[model samples]
Target: MTTTLTTPTTTGPSRARRVAALARGETRLLLRNRTAVVNSVLLPLLLVAAVPAMDLGGDVPLGPQLLSTAVGVTLVFLTYYNLVSTYVARREDLVLQRMRTGELTAPEVLLGTAVPSLLISLGQVVVVAVGVAVLGEWSAPVEYLLPLVAVLLGTAVMTVLAAASTLFTRTPESAQITTLPLMVATTSLSGLLYPISSFPDWLSTVARLLPVTPVIELLQLGLAGRTWDGEVVDAGGAWAAAPLPLAVLAGWLVIGGVAARGFRWAPRR
Candidate 1:
């Protein structure tokens, strides 16, 4: 008679516990990088501080514009760009590979690594909102849910985009170059700083498809109850107009998700 021996399965920490532990470690590393501290945290806030100085002119409300721009800045610099550097650094250091060899799920690993950046992004949102309220005399958002949704979805999109971006970035330093195209496009063409309507018709149509454009568009509608072309919208109309931009964001999320699935945990040979 032949007998087979089986090994029992063992469970480790809960997903939340595991992720939190990783986040704590990453937060410490992030704080140690003074350049990242300034670039990822300070620079975006500084840019948001400058938003109010823009001569946007006419009926364009400074409050919505400022808040929307702040959201975009947070998404780009604080979340997306910072995460690209983090992922690349960790991958090169073999941290991601070592983590994957353990009990942590891939999602948990990525999410944990992303926790600090996400927190900073959310904190900046609060800071910007309060600044607009107290200083800019900004009224509360017309449909608060829409702007909230915009930020949440935008964060997810940026997170995945950052992961996908690592495919081309061989090192942490090269991340700056690899990330520049999307950064520039989102800032310049996504209507974060300037209105997309100001672009020529074809260019505006193209710009509308960018990952961050829908985010800014959603914020504009939610905060100001105004459509992208400056049309005043009621609460109902604001939500009604949401599906198109939401679909656009969803598309980018799907695309980024696919690309990120191919992300390499180990450094290139």
Candidate 2:
């Protein structure tokens, strides 16, 4: 008679515990990067300080514009660009791949990686609110839900886009270069740093095509209380009336999701 021996598999930490642990570790690493903290957290606050000086007599109030721009930079720096570098580093170091082979589901892995960034992003939002209130009168947005929606949607979109961006990013070092194009486009053209309403119709039309424009516009609507009466100013501000509100943002999220499906999870051999 022949007997067969079987080995039982052991489970890892509970889902909540696993995610929390990953987030704690990731947060530590994230904080250890002093340059990241300074650039992502401090620089945006500095920009907020400068926003007041750049008002230059606009229809949009300086307070709302400054607050919106400040918050927008936080989202980009903490959520979007930060994730690109984080994901690339993790993937290169095989952290992501190892997690994939464990008890962590793909969603869990993604959530774990994003936990630190999201927390930092949320904290910065509060800081912006309080700082703006302290510096100037803080009137809540007329469309309150829109700003929250903008933050939620923007965070999700940027997270997915960051993952997708890793497909072409060979190493963590090259992330800055690959990320620069989108960063510049979104910060400059998506109405994050300035109002697209102030732009020419032709320029606004082009800016609206950018993935981040809808989120930025929603942010302006939410944080800056900016709403156009579908009235186009010059030839460049057509983006003000574009069909890129929630619909456009959702579309970009889908695009990012699709793009991430093709990502290489392991470092190239």
Candidate 3:
């Protein structure tokens, strides 16, 4: 039998398309991980439910604190914590190393790996906002646009932190320990559960300096516009807190970038 063979096209899938495919694969893997799925969805909700017990100050109210808690907890568990384990798992499995040897660039691989987590984090943020809105009325209108800046910037910071932390993570199982410092420190002192305004002058000042503080601050500034009487309040207005936190976020981003330069794609020897 005689047959004619056709040559394949010189152009394959576009770069964006390839990256998208990678993200899809990453998302599927995340879905298959039962623990990851549960933590990403349920953990944030559980954490936020405790806002009633948190002292976000008398003026801040449980509703506003709940909203802030939802955003902060979701971002931490869904994006930052998840990425640490995922990156370590990929490194241990040799997936990252294999990708480096193929057509996918390092940046593409990192971005692709982040896609699933980022999407879930954003979804959690939405759920938090909706639940807060549906529960009752905000004393002041939600500054939807301003807090979005915090979410976007905070996510970038967390992504970098995850990448950096994975360098020390020996295995997927060790991810919990490697990730604990950040989770514990930030949750306790970063105002993730409580408001900075609820703090004494000394504590609020110090809290603002923590790596995670700016994120929680920005989220609260945007989502929780309640007034506080006995606690620390910044001069000027709610917007006054914006610039300093933004600058702090930028500084952390730089540090994360510097740390990433030493990232080891291959397993540690």
Best by lDDT: 1
RMSD of 2: 7.4
Q: How far off is residue 87 in model 3, in Å?
A: 0.5
Root-mean-square deviation (CA) per prediction: 5.7, 7.4, 7.8
Report the alpha-carbon TM-score of model 2 versus the true structure: 0.84
What is the lDDT of every predicted structure here? 0.84, 0.71, 0.72
Per-residue lDDT of 105 in model 3: 63
What is candidate 3's lDDT per residue for 169-202, written digit by digit as tens?
8898898898898888788877765556667988
The sequence of per-residue lDDT tens digits that candidate 2 reaches over residues 1-269 is 11111222334557678889899999899889898677667765776566556763335556666666665676676687778888888888889888777777665677788898888878777776777777774765655667677778878888888888887888878988998898898888777655676789999888876767776666556545555322313212333433467787788889998887776667876
How well does model 3 score by local distance difference test?
Answer: 0.72
